[model samples]
Target: MANIEFFDRTMLEAMSLLAESRRYLTDKAEAESQKMDLEQGLANSMETMRLVARLTQVLAWLLTHRAVHAGEMSIAEATVPDRRLGGRDLCAKDSSDAAKTLPDELQSLLSRSHSLYLRIARLDDQATARAEINTKVSGGPRPQ
Candidate 1:
């Protein structure tokens, strides 16, 4: 009867240890999952920032061109409207001509903006790949 009791206590202790180990593994897996999610979020945020920077650069170039063109048009003599059209048409023509003759500096800025956009796109793709990898790592079957 004493041997039977001893065996029962040993079985209970073994089960308790197994339960504790399982809980520890579960907690560890949860922590790792949280870490992966955080990393993915950070990568997404970084990609968004890169996109914002590219857009800002493009907008700045456009604004600068508009400002410079407006200044030049302000000093020029306005043309009279033809008999077939209104006075606004003459100003529109002048503005169109001015746009066609953008300064070299403005062209350079546009080129740089295009390059920046391409770089941002590449970085976004890289971030997406990294996030996918992290997701797979956290969710996939454990290694032996």
Candidate 2:
């Protein structure tokens, strides 16, 4: 019950952060207006993409667990590969050096999103491990 509440709080917070970041990006000045060089512009784009991807992954994973809790999805189903947390390769990568020049809000969003993604990824791993152990104990088919 506590885990569910914790994830619920985290999900709401992540959603709010995602919305705020979106608004900031939408209202932000164009790269040229900010006098960003080509490299800086590219870095900004990449970091922005990473930020969105990270949050999207977090939301999807949270929603999956939410469904399980709601009885709309089984725990076994949620642990499946397709339903598991994703975008690790992209979301886990370090922000580019040029991304350091981005606006402070953007930097903070990036940091927070990355941290949240990592936290959820750890949970995902733990879930997978538990599912694997359950399969072994039950002599059931292994998780794909």
Candidate 3:
């Protein structure tokens, strides 16, 4: 059975990667992207934006789960859409041509972030359902 556990190594690793990826994407990757020719610049900037957006979504999901695990927010509060994963549709799109040309490290980071997000998303959904069940069992108000 799945539950939101904040201190586990998995959470640590995910948070670390999110932090590292953010720095790399915003600093190194963004810097190199500025030197591209006009067309290439547009493509690279667009791809970079996508990468940033995807990672940002993943970070939000992780933080919300951490808050729940820490008892700072109830499961129902965490389940609110704003606190839940956003940009699901944006993440759903297949990699674009520009994605293939990204620096190898950036490409890998993008893939890892997306895959990690999906895995965590599944865990979050299961945790939400379990929370609802527990609430009901305890005679607490049910999620609407």
Best by lDDT: 2
The C-alpha RMSD of each candidate to the native structure, in angstroms, is: 34.0, 1.9, 3.2
Ranking by lDDT: 2, 3, 1
For residues 1-144, write the lDDT of model 1, one tens digit per residue.
673454345335434433543454355434533444565545433332332344443333333323434554210111111111122222112222222233333233333433544443343344345545655767843222
| Candidate 3 C-alpha error for residue 13, in Å | 2.1
Estimate TM-scores for all models. Answer: 0.29, 0.90, 0.74
Tell me the spans in candidate 2 whose CA falls farther than 4 Å from its real position: 29-34, 96-98, 142-144
The segments of candidate 3 whose C-alpha lies over 4 angstroms from its true place after superposition are 1-7, 96-98, 135-140
* Best prediction by TM-score: 2
| Tens digit of per-residue lDDT, candidate 2, span 9-82 | 99889999889888887888364336777777778888888998998899999989989889997677789999
lDDT of each: 0.36, 0.84, 0.71
TM-score order of candidates, best first?
2, 3, 1
Model 1 misplaced regions, further than 4 Å: 1-53, 57-100, 140-144
Q: Measure candidate 3: CA RMSD.
A: 3.2
